[model samples]
Target: MTERNTDLEARTEAKPLPRVSPATDILEREDGFYVYMDIPGVRREDLKIDINENEMVVTGRAGQAASEKETFLEVQFGPGEYIRAVSLSDLVDREHIKASLKDGVLTIHLPRLEKASPRRIPVQSA
Candidate 1:
């Protein structure tokens, strides 16, 4: 086989490949920001969320087979790594961030830093 053919074969044989298309939502509030992601067929233990500085990373793996007799008909979504990185304008308090997954919907609450929150300053006449 030619080099191109070999590369194609390798690509076809690779398992657990990422699809790269995922639905996400980011909402900003007065107090903080909320990130919502839809990840179907993913278990709680299979999901991973990481936050570093101003970047947030979400990753998960979907199982390929539920049983030996079952097979995928339309395999757009498959057993693969799902990764997404988002940058935040507001400083986030990593220590207080909360995450929860329910019914394939992952919701993450990123609280803004204490110093980053908006404060009202008293005005004085000069």
Candidate 2:
């Protein structure tokens, strides 16, 4: 019998992940700004909301991992992550930003800072 020696090498390639952009609507009013986004299939546990001094970021993933192998006749949705970033100014109060997710829609409330709101000037007799 003869002895043999073998060696194996492994290689890896870097790839970029896909990102999805959800439908969003921005409304501006005298009191504040309202942001509504449509993110179907996303769950509360998979959602993330980040508020910065000058920006807001939202990211989430839709659907759950399959327990077993399955087949699909029609597939309209794919496994991906939803990401969106919005720019903000000093007029918005970052501390008061609130968000809620319901019925596959994400709502964000951005209240205007007091100094940013319009005030009526009072006149006085000299």
Question: For residues 87-118, what per-residue lDDT tens digits would candidate 2 score against the true structure?
Answer: 98889998888899999999999999988788
Worst 10 residues of 1 by lDDT: 68-77
Angstrom error of the Cα, residue 28, model 2: value is 1.8
Worst 10 residues of 2 by lDDT: 4-13
Looking at model 2, the pairs that clash are none
Question: For each candidate, how many residue pairs have backbone atoms clashing (under 3 Å)?
Answer: 0, 0
| TM-scores, all models, native as reference | 0.75, 0.76
Segments of candidate 1 deviating more than 4 angstroms: 1-13, 71-76
Highest TM-score against the true fold, candidate: 2
* Candidate 2, superposed: residue stretches over 4 Å from native: 1-17, 64-67, 122-126
